[model samples]
Target: MPTLKQKPKQRPFCFSVKGHVKILRLVLTVTSMTFFIIAQAPEPYIVITGFEVTIIFFFIVLYTVRLDRLVNCVFWPLLDVINSMVAAVFMILISMLALIPETTTYIVIGGVFGLAASVFCIADGALIYRKLLFNPSGPYQKTAVHDRF
Candidate 1:
């Protein structure tokens, strides 16, 4: 009789599939916040909100990336996807608003950063979507266990 072998489980701290996206997200978030702070814009609330959200999520992703097992939970991926989508939309809107006719150099720089962040967020969202929704054997897939009689 032939014996069936099960595939080995992935390590908990193994590199995440979304590693690149997460790093880019962190960089873009920090850059956007720094530029927004330095810019002398009339309204800083949008950037402030974006910065706060980005900081919070950045830490969450950082922690989860190190502990990949946490990502197996349904809530984490859903939250990440939704957050990325919202952040992208908000950044786009803010960037467009920041591009007024009389914008200063700093404001223009900040707007550019915001736009870049928006693009990153959108890419992250798409990657998350692929990981969660599109991939059949992804983290969310269920495996059946069999017992010999």
Candidate 2:
């Protein structure tokens, strides 16, 4: 019989069938626990679900990006998707309100506000994505590359 000091061995980073499942379960349990804790927070702001931090982060990022170079890259295209979604939402709500004559003024107000926000969102997302993904082409290139985007 094997001595009490002897134990079965396992390869590093190579989980057995049972071990792999256990790791997955552990990861999922931790993730769900974190999500529930965040969900329980009071006075949640930023109407967009699950992206509140993203909005604040982008706002800060846009304050720093150089707008000229960004237009040449992929930021503008992806922003189009975001803007279209915003516009479509505004249009649907406005159309529904148009059926009620009293809401015509509110519809106009909402449309204008929506249009402005859509533009801001596009510009902000593009600028932030570019800033986080690229570095200034100067002495800081190598060092910045090592840091987070």
How far is 125's C-alpha from truth in model 2 (Å)? 0.3
What stretches of model 2 exceed 4 Å from their correct place? 1-102, 136-149
Candidate 1 has an lDDT of 0.66
lDDT of 1 by residue, 19-101 (tens): 66666666766666666667656656345545645654664555556543555554556666788888888778777777765
What lDDT does model 2 reach? 0.37
Give the CA lDDT, 0 to 100, for residue 39 in model 1: 66
Scored by TM-score, the top model is 1
Kindly report which residue stretches of model 1 are placed more than 4 angstroms away from their true locations once superposed.
Answer: 1-17, 43-74, 137-149
Q: What is the lDDT of residue 70 in candidate 1?
A: 53
Tens-digit lDDT track of model 2 for 1-149: 87677676744322433224223323332332233234442122112212422433342244235342465655542453464345335434433333344334433343343334444444444433443444523334344655876
Residue pairs with backbone overlap in model 1 = none
| TM-score of each prediction | 0.67, 0.28
The worst-scoring run of ten residues by lDDT in candidate 2 lies at 41-50
